[model samples]
Target: MKLKNLRYSCRHCNTEVGSIPFASAEEVIRELQRAEEGNGEHFLEYDDNGSMTVRCICEQCEQSLRMNPDYYALRKWIQ
Candidate 1:
């Protein structure tokens, strides 16, 4: 059986962070199933090869957001 790969990337800059190898996606799938409608969709993406990509903020963006608290008010602050 093909193992599932979990990839992490920065949501703002779209930079790939890292990845984890998983023998099965059962646990991950279960947790995702319990997430609220839009919540899961916003952070998770599935690949045709059965891998999953999670979108999260990176350290640089996090620092930027911390420095510019007002950026939080905008929908897209990176641009």
Candidate 2:
């Protein structure tokens, strides 16, 4: 059996938060497909090696966003 990998990184800063090894992609695909309608593309990505990279916000970025809610108006907030 082949192992599947799921890498989580911060969308704003590209900081790698963590990774998990999955027995199969089935579970991950199912969960990602359940994402809000057409917005699934924003969260899921397949790398060159076929591994999945899940775009997510890290703690630092999340805190920054909370401190500066206006940053949400910009497409890329980190400056």
Candidate 3:
């Protein structure tokens, strides 16, 4: 069986932030189920190839957002 990997990327800049690996597909499913039960906000996406992607802000974009809180209202920064 192929191992499932969780990839994290910046939502605005599209920078690859981090990744988590699962020993098996079952492990990945369990984690996803747990996440669904939790109340915290999480960005989860399933790709056509069966990989998972999580959208999050990187350090640089986080700093930018802190400087300009208005950017949070926009889905993505055009510049």
Candidate 4:
């Protein structure tokens, strides 16, 4: 099996944010374990092709969110 990493992008601005590689099943399990231990704010998705995607906010969006907290309630700001 080949490992694949799908980078996350800002849902509003389409900026690349972060990535996680599923090099092995164990690695995927480890990530899940870590997520379960935390508050589980991060977004994760799995595709039928075996790729994993981790959604996160970019620095610019972070600043925008800090400046305008109301954007957090919108589903999409740029579209």
C-alpha RMSD for every candidate: 2.9, 2.9, 3.5, 3.9
Best first by lDDT, ranked: 2, 1, 3, 4
Worst 10 residues of 3 by lDDT: 21-30
Best by TM-score: 2
Model 1 RMSD in angstroms: 2.9
lDDT of each candidate versus the true structure: 0.78, 0.80, 0.72, 0.65
Worst 10 residues of 4 by lDDT: 20-29
Write the number of the candidate with greater lDDT, choosing between 1 and 2.
Answer: 2
**Of 1 and 3, the candidate ranking higher by lDDT:** 1
**Clashes, model 1:** 0
**Which lDDT tens digits does candidate 3 get at residues 20-55?**
765545566567657867742467666765567777
lDDT of 1 by residue, 1-79 (tens): 2437877899888989887776555676557646635578888887788677788898999999999999888988777
Worst 10-residue lDDT window for candidate 1 reads 29-38
Across 11-79, the per-residue lDDT of candidate 4 in tens digits comes to 568677766555535566456547946854457655777665556678888898899899878877655
Give the Cα-based TM-score of candidate 2 against the true structure.
0.81
TM-score of each: 0.74, 0.81, 0.70, 0.60
Looking at model 4, the pairs that clash are none
Which rank order by TM-score, best down to worst?
2, 1, 3, 4
Please give the TM-score that candidate 1 achieves against the real structure. Answer: 0.74
Which candidate would rank higher by TM-score, 1 or 2? 2
* TM-score, model 4 to reference: 0.60
